[model samples]
Target: MAVPGHKLDRMFNPEVVAVVGDKGPGYMWLRNNLPFKEKGGRLYSVQLDEKEIPGIEALGIQNFKSMADIPEPIDYALVAVPRQVSPYVLKDLIANKANGAGFFTSGFAETGEELGVKLQTQLTEMAREASFNLVGPNCMGLYLPKVGVRFNADAPVADDGKIGFLSQSGTHGIMFSLVSAANGMHVSRCASFGNAVVLDVSDYLEYLMLDDETEVIGMYVEGVKNGRRFFETLREACKRKPVIVWKGGQTEAGARATMSHTGSLAAPQAVWDGMMRQCGAITTNNLDETIDVMKLLLNAKRPTGTGMALLAQTGGQSVSITDAFSKAGLRVPRFSDGTYTELGEFFNIVGGSFQNPLDMAGTIQGSMDTLDRILRILDADPNVDAMAMELSAMFAARQWKGKPETLDKTIEEIALHKERSKKPFLVILHPAHEAEYVASIQPKFHAANIPLFQSFERAAAAFARVLGGGGRARTRTGVVGLALETQPR
Candidate 1:
């Protein structure tokens, strides 16, 4: 049993930090942007010769010549200087007994250089001896809202507190933040641990499990720091909060390329699949699906074990959603005779027969109204535990004509009214480009605990997955996009 508590406390709640680097955007970025000036986490800047960056307010202390100059007990260090100079920096941190460090400078083993690999090995040895945890020699560290922790112009976690995202690419970490923000997914923290030297994915997983702020966890992986330990952490976290992994650089070809870059060993797909299932982790097909499930798990009710409901305004959508439920291995239970009769009473408008995929348009006119009826019907059905709504805003110029165009606001209201239900509720809006307006609905979904997705198929699949005992909890959801995030203009 790896104890992650002591390591996590030193990282997130660090009281003093030493950032070593040349005059570059990375170091200056932190100085100008860190929100911790008020958190009392003292920051010390280190450079070989240069001093006095242009915009920083004078802290009155001269730029430290070395780690020894800083008399304070440094909790964390960021080695962002040139790669050639990194080993020395790591040595300094170790000598000072720094709690941990996020080594953002690349060009080590990842560069495929013999000397670079040697550098990483030596630094790892030094770190182990010093008893300090390390995140990356070529990565971004972690994000924690509770302690005012973040990187310079990095980590775009929304202000809401719903999930935590961890990735191996700092780029993915930053992009996930922005996409999560655009989609309205609030997060407790997001970390991009590149080239893990000491602390790796498993370490973060253990920490997030104990983190009261996170309800779910999302990961984008180029490599796992330790596979066995990772599975151990995943097993425990899945029992608590849902864990979703997007195994990037996943193919054999891509994995081979990874070894040269970071000496990483990508696992086989079959092995990965069985591992995820045993630990109860939801493995995604791609980056898109990964983010889709992450946001939705934040909204799903609970891992209910087998049925679903499909609600759409049009028969075509109903047909597609029904097919999706079937393919996902979930049953769309036909409405009970009594339930059918009650819905039939309103058949004057909804002429279609009331079935599992109820095209309830007669009495339900708007997105809000349609969803309301669907919710009532599904809630009453013990067999139907989850639902998928195919929504194409009538106002969306490309799809429908009657859309209130105000569907975002209307959807917001419905969620607010149904805030208490834990059943998996999802709406898949057809692809469109009115980004700003469509994206506006995100905050409300997060607020109401219902998840909104851009792909109808993903929305349906997520519902089936959770209800079929293949996914985690229910009701509210979100999407952290990588490419084609269904951005609202």
Candidate 2:
């Protein structure tokens, strides 16, 4: 039976959450619940062991001997008991009528042992009979920042994040949330539904599609139980919100690995690819590409066309930038005749070239006013649909030796130009060896909402995907999909 929408809502944004079987060694799940408590939500610890009670109490959480002992209803419960003990705990949760429960216990069907399969079947039948909302028999469930719920203690939480993510692997879920957050993209909600025996991926997809807080949806999946329902929900979701899917187990070896990992039947590669294309959903290979694509979809303004204007600090960088963007299916075309006339007036040709991929080696030696003029010329060029600039930390550190304020002012001018210009603007800040220099300017560009990449290749690949209609779907009449309409920026 499908869980009610209201019940799932309570589970994601629970007012009262309980952590069962949390012990003294690490107090792992107990520590995970501290964020919820810090956000003013009620937290209770269900530990029958007298040895564990003191540890739970020391953390300032109320300890209960059993679920029945709790005075109020539980919106969500995290169970981490042994496999044999889980059935007993499920009875308690079912009787308590908890809105939702996630089992962190392993040794279920994924074990492929007779006892493991039997235990999983037993739990699945019991939950279905009672119409209970179970997240996973082996998973690190929900991470809703608005409710201060998180699987990892260090995971960031903010009320204004717009990215929603779902993963079949707990490790991917944790890493994706952290990586995306570090790159200025915060997650509104993230779920790591492992061995999804009850509530599957499609259920979460439908909910996230309708969620007002979630503007873009990203998923990491091993496989699905119901292929028809999964793709059907995906098709509908792509119409309402941009869905980026990172499917695991495309190869034969990977397919075998996924079965052991999640007890999922991995789909054939050809079928998976065809269905994703038919649904108009975006596909990614690895975690880095997934984050890169999501960053562009959430941050960059959609380019009118794939035409790009590249700028770099050196001649070698200019050549590499042109090759990278061009190879990624984006055009680095020549400037219009009028644009060349305007640049010829002040752009020095002795140390710089003012062609398509402008080598601005000499331009940066001039004042910020001069650099701003070059940017304005490119922004007004009809041949340029988008612009990408390579900012070299080594060059900036050498040229501005002690004038740090000048570098800051130059960045601000570029940001202002991007804000008012019609073209999408991007920055590639390279060579992490100069961490101090890159660190100083990263926040300034991020605050101004400019998409910053560490390499030209990464920026080019992400930009090409965005320009190829990877994020937005168009209707027969040529109108933007609902996802684009509802998306902010």
Highest lDDT model number = 2
Highest-TM-score candidate:
2
- In angstroms, how far off is 267's CA in candidate 1? 1.8
C-alpha lDDT score of every prediction, in listed order: 0.66, 0.83
Q: Give per-residue CA lDDT, model 1, range 336-372, as digits (tens).
A: 7767776766554436546778776544655566556
The alpha-carbon lDDT assigned to residue 18 of candidate 2 equals 93
Error of 2 at 252 (Å): 1.4
How many residue pairs clash per model? Answer: 24, 0
Worst 10 residues of 1 by lDDT: 480-489
Q: Write the per-residue lDDT of candidate 2 for residues 1-489, one digit (tens) a residue.
A: 123464478787788999989888789888887889999999999999999888888899999998999888888899889998998888898898888888888888898889988888888888888988888888888888877888888788787788889999989999999988777788998888888888889888988888888999999998887776787788888888788899999899999998789888777777787667667778888999888888778767766788898999889999999999989989988899999999988787887899989998687674778878888989888889999998887677665457878767877887788778878888898854687767666777667677889899999988876666454553342212221121000
RMSD of each: 7.2, 5.2
